[model samples]
Target chain A: MTLKKKQLIECQSLWKIFGQKAKTAMQAVKERNLTKEQVHNEFDCIVGVQNATFSVDEGEIFCIMGLSGSGKSTLIRHINRLIEPTSGEIFIDGENINNLNQTELREIRSSKIGMVFQNMALLPHKNVRENVAFALELRGIDKKSRDKVANETLETVELSGWGDRYPDELSGGMQQRVGLARAIAANPQILLMDEPFSALDPLIRRQLQDQFIELSQIMHKTTIFITHDLDEAIRIGQRIAIMKDGMLVQIGEPEDIVTDPVDDYVAKFVSGISNLHLVTAGKIMQSIAEYEASAGPVKEESLLKAKLDDDLDCLIDLSIKTDEPILIESESKIVGIVSKKTLLAGIQGHWNT
Target chain B: MADEVKFSILDPFSAIDIGIADWADGIKEWATNNREAIQPVKNYLNDVIIWMNDVLQALPPLITIACIAIISLQFAGKKVTGIVVICLVAIGFLDPRAWDLTMTTLSIVVTSVLISAIIGLPLGILAGKSDRFEQLIRPILDTMQTIPAFVYLVPVVMLVGIGNVSGVLVTIVFALPPLVRLTSLGIRQVNPSIVEAAKAFGASPSQILCKVELPLSAPSIMAGLNQTIMLALSMVVIASMIAVKGLGNEVLRAMGRLDAGKAIVGGAGIVLLAIVLDRITESFGLSKREKGVRHWWESGPIGLFYNQYKKLN
Candidate 1:
């Protein structure tokens, strides 16, 4: 966990305004500090992304979470240059992608990045295998090798025999699997998934999420996932960035966001999320000295013990069996203590110092 | 002041006439003077029409009927094939001259459709991709579509001279708009996300057009082709007034002689041909899903041979 990974994707002060007057609107925003609403009212331009900045580490699942129209989708599109930014710099693996020519951009896209859409968008005319192999076809790969790859990728997504079937013949969940298969078939280094499972039923969505997490673990492809659901972001993202009105409000780990929301906007989103598994013992624990001073010295043998990284759910389970406070250890030394009261506070979105 | 205003209103405002008619006449004069430049094109078109007509005429009537039946069976299935065969037989029985007239008309219709598709498809695709191009062509297409076929017939006869070639030229003018409009519409109507998805995967603009947009818009394009073929059929009859030989000429001659029987026979042949062509082309546009699980070689003459071969084995 302490291993240092290189940053693979970075965005610096990205801005995207829509409409014919976008250039003037962007200038107004920079010069006179116009708000999103003011820009829309004055210039008839809709702000898509507003000076957003973030980066993803290599092999990290970085999730951008926001409601519809918050520009999370727009922000993701900028990574692939699908929707060009009005102004900003994007670095992929230390290369400033904004400077890349169209051919270079396409070269990078074909070899390095893969994207899955919310709608699947699988070609109706193509059979599932052909659809999966389409990216390879674009790269001018031979039919035999690409089909081989497509079949293998399909098998990985548990769609072994469905390759010959057209997209419409498959169920919604199956179609989503085909979409995922298509993205990974080219063996791209980066994956951009835009709410890929949002259209499915809850049961199928969770199933696909689990499969995706398992796939990502084995592949270790750097990913930037976009979703409107906070729970989804919390579940899948190593780090979550929350956006509102085309601006990123806060970016942090799921535990950090849930336990310490930056403002009411994010607080409202996380308030409904169950953080039993997200709030760690290290986050809510008090100093071992402070705990001893308050309730006298505790015998470590009588109380259950947990590591610093153990979640509140674990602490709660440990606290149920024993009335004594649990000891939080890191590197084999007692660092902090979590009692039932502290566990309750952690569950209620409060952190004990 | 009131008297001056009344005089201004009554003045008729005839100061400027744009002189579009004079401009048109100037173009006609230029084309006539430069007729040699277009002679090769005219000769090539005439040869192709005559060649196609000869090929059709050389085939035995029974062979032609069988070919149509097999094709209909392959595309539109047994029911449509049956109706088409019955209609063809009926036309042939009603007028002994119907067969030859139908063949000539078919050749002309096919050639005109081929030329329209060749010209209209690229123009439509270009218009589809660029708003400015589409805007520029919109009024031209509207004018082409709205003007009566007879109006252009005069200009076309003057430029190309009266023959099957002029007939083709006029038919192209009449039929090209629908295909172009539909092709443009088809490209434009493709889902934006689908195009975006293709782009995200590193598809070039042309790659996106060929692999995604074109395939998705195929039904629309086919619909356009259907419309174009129908328009060409209608226009070919009108083109016969310029001495183009076909079922239309038969009807025209019969009309001059006041022979209702001959006219009805020609009309019947045209209708029968239209129905068969419409149904077959329509079948091509039907998605595989809608057409069910039938394989291409499983229902036509090929299928019959395959089944027999299987049984023999």
Candidate 2:
């Protein structure tokens, strides 16, 4: 998507170091990016996040994908001041949050930003209703009203009637749903989820992801999602950013990133994604009547389409004569056609040419 | 017939008396030799002795009932129970003469318990946080716990000489082991995952202690406190010997004159106090079972605790 909406949250040149001399070394940081070894040596610091800059527009599902220690969680945490950026400016809705006082920061935490952690991190001692209303309570909502909203939030997450149950009573997926409801119950402007579904089973993870997709459409809350799963970033994120070490290597729409990766790290991630069943007909369909005809008749739609598993041998279908424009049929008639050369080139991203 | 004339007379001294003197002499000799190695234990004993003497000399009678009742309500929450009320009322009935003496005895107990908590809590923290501290304290705690209540007095007498101070000292010495050790054990037993979670939540050290550590480990600490108080109570007669006033002296006096009724009533009263206090302490221990100190959703979550939660709501 284009940058059509107003930006809600932005980070510029963020840095974090973990030692007594962090202040001194941070003073010496001149360039935009610092090497891990240099950071470690200068201050005996563990560089948690480095020079990270990104702006999440209102209502956008922005994802930061990285492996463990890629600093994605730390970077996201900077938004809420959960882990204060060592030396950077985080602006929420055009206001620089670096100087927000304790009370102001707490207000922001309760009313503006909500988060979901990897372990679900639900207060185990409380039941679903209590947990759902927990942050709301922190913000000072009355019991009757908070309970009403908590129940509604629970219903939104498809967890209605489960509110009376405690965290221990729910399964991993259910607990995460509770976490989701908790985050959204306060009706915050932005939601930050750091691998919230990482602990659930695969089936449950997919289910929750789908729910998020539905909810994001209806809820329309700006969300920053963090995950290591590339496909997840593709399926759920409108725009996905890939990170390695502590730097953003690439960021783009899911298909654009998958079909045309920025570098080897992203390419490696793209190649392993097998959920090709989700690719639309519009993405792969082509016109095949442009080339020379062969002996046998092949459908235009068939010639234009090739599965990810299909090789060049698939062009040997009798529907088309040798050396003719490749063709394939759809419901009733021949559709667009293409030659093997053109098809291969398109798969190789020659469409731009 | 001439030799039998003297033998027929009753022997003046009993064999049991001879054995008691030998045991006392042996302990004194051993204590002198091992005094240096046992300096910490000795210091602890001295502190207990001094504090107990002060309390035994100062505490009043009616206040003892109030202490028991207050503690009982907090602990068991069964305020208005007949037995508890009866126990409270009985203190008032202890013939007007017994009133001041009862409180004198009580003042020593309550104060020593307060001191025990102050001292034992830190020691328990040390023991809980460090394996080496625990190892170092194990034998000493074991000795304190295992030694008879009466035995504490002998050591108290040796160190501070006979008086209320020595009596109170012996009570504290015998009672503190449980509280210190259990507090350590309970804190150590709290779930590490929860502690880590609290840290991730931006909880400061003080907040973690007040919110997570103490609330979670309350049961064990209360258990320790309860044990300590009961042990302090047991030291009464032994304490009375050191001039600490209380029912112990009444029992001892009655015994001297073979006054069976006074002895029975005094002993029964002490037993009643023990039951009342023990129930109250166990009630306080129930705090551990209270919902996780986190907010509940209904009345604007009870925030991290009762106070902040109230403010938030």
Candidate 3:
């Protein structure tokens, strides 16, 4: 969440079209009075992704949230060239990726980026291990080595010993966990998930979001997670980019986005959503000593409970070693204590800008 | 006290006529026409024919049927039992001379089917790839199929004369439509998503067809092949009147002499052949699903082949 802009994968003025004559029509726009919409109408090309741009930093869960056909999918696809950009550039680790050949692009895809499609797109034919091994297999890794890595990756997603099961055999959440394993197994520097949990039940989705957040915590893969639900974006994303009709309407941390939306589209999304889901380690995270902790250390206020998914009640009367230690009170006793500097430093990157 | 009407392929509609009266004129005209179309028809009836005379003549009735039995054993296994038994019984009851004529009819039908399949599959793929070609060929297949089975013989008899070659040729014309229609339909019905999946996996167009489209549509294509084989069988009897030997000739010869016993035996021979042909082609479709061979290219025999290919490459 504290990853910097230099670590960001950035998109600049991206446009994508769904038609054969896209290039020629875009050219016509360049030469004459034809506007983008005019050219689109004349040529029967849809401007699915239009002049969109955003940045997602390393370790930040950047979510692109929008309704179906709002170009959120098209824009996310631009990151990995599943759908190519009609115009503009995408830069990952300061390298522009639009001009790569098929081989070069596939290499980039195998190493630099991974994707979990909305449908999970688990090769219907392969069992869990094989699906997880797909990107590695594409990279020409031999079966034994890829299988070993796949098992380890499945463990990381809490799906150990499920390596032999088929995607259809697993529950939707488990299948998604397998899908997430497949994406993360390659250890791609950037992970792209297109509404991966949309197909799961609400209870399962919340569990998955928590699981994904915990997994990302350790792996630190720069994740671009797409979803339509504002609550999902606010809960899981460190920073969220709300998209509408092929444009990025706002890009900010979840709390900032909820409180100060840039447009009516984002405003409408934020209004009905529960603000509770937006509370994360980065928000509602106080400098432990700054709050009144006279009763003792109230470990419930600590970011570890929020970050690690450990029970808040487990931290009762828990002690911590810190310079300039301050007490945190739950009810009548000290639960935990930590240095104010350490608490605040975890939240440093966002407050300045 | 007889009803007289204008000469036509249609029926005379006499009060004495039954449902089969509709089929009567076409056969009568066909017989009259077959005698006139080729001078050799009369000669072949009384003398030896080359492919028919040599191939069917060299094999005794027992040996000829034993070959069909062996083929059924290899391809269809247990299902061949009833067919083999029925064939043996039918051959036992048939007048001995008619067996050679029936084998000739069987030979032509099998040969024409092979030719139709070879031609139809490629043309189907062509139609699948291009809508323009499909639109152009659609009506031709329609006309080729819809023109009555007996009516086609009149024209083919004119072109090549009433002989064994023309008989087989006419069978091809009648039976080919189903092959062409089914192949194109199967290929066209291949899943779009699967096609995209193959392309995304870097499969070339030919690879897509060989691996994805063709295997998935095998059932449909097999159905077409089955129907074509049936169509060829149906045409054999009509074709037999014109010096095409086999069961059709036996049936016609029996009808000429008014022998119901000979007619039933020949008809039974045709039925046995039809069952044998149907089972084999149906097995060809069933073979894919027989031993859990969905996506066969992934593993099993195909995977072994791929491994060998990789080594060679």
Best by DockQ: 1
Better of 1 and 3 by DockQ: 1
Listing candidates in order, what is each one's chain A TM-score? 0.95, 0.82, 0.75
Per-residue lDDT for A1-353 in model 3, tens only?
Answer: 84345666889888777788988876665577464478677998776876777877777788888899889877877787767788889988888888777777767777777777667666555678987887777667899999999999999988999897777678888988987888778788888888988989999999999888888888888899999988888778888888887778788888778756787878788878644334233332345454545434554543332232222222222324333434333454444343344344422322212
Which prediction has more favorable lDDT, 2 or 3? 2
Task: For candidate 1, write residues B208-248 as lDDT tens digits.
Answer: 99999998888889999999999988876688999989899
Candidate with maximal lDDT = 1
Candidate 2 per-residue C-alpha lDDT over B1-313 given as tens digits, one digit per residue, 9 for 90 to 100: 3433232236644312447768877876775566567557646755664565565446554564556555454435444335676875775586665655565567677767887888899999889888999999999999987877676566556655665656666777888898998999998987775554444343455655666677678778888888888988887877787777788888888888999988987787687767766766665565423533332231111222556656788
Off by over 4 Å in 2: A1-3, A28-34, A275-353, B1-214, B220-224, B227-242, B247-313
**What TM-score does each model's chain B reach against the true chain B?**
0.90, 0.70, 0.71
Per-residue lDDT for B141 in model 1? 97
For all predictions, the C-alpha RMSD in Å is 3.3, 12.4, 10.7
Model 3 Cα shift for residue B9 (angstroms): 34
Indicate which candidate wins on TM-score: 1
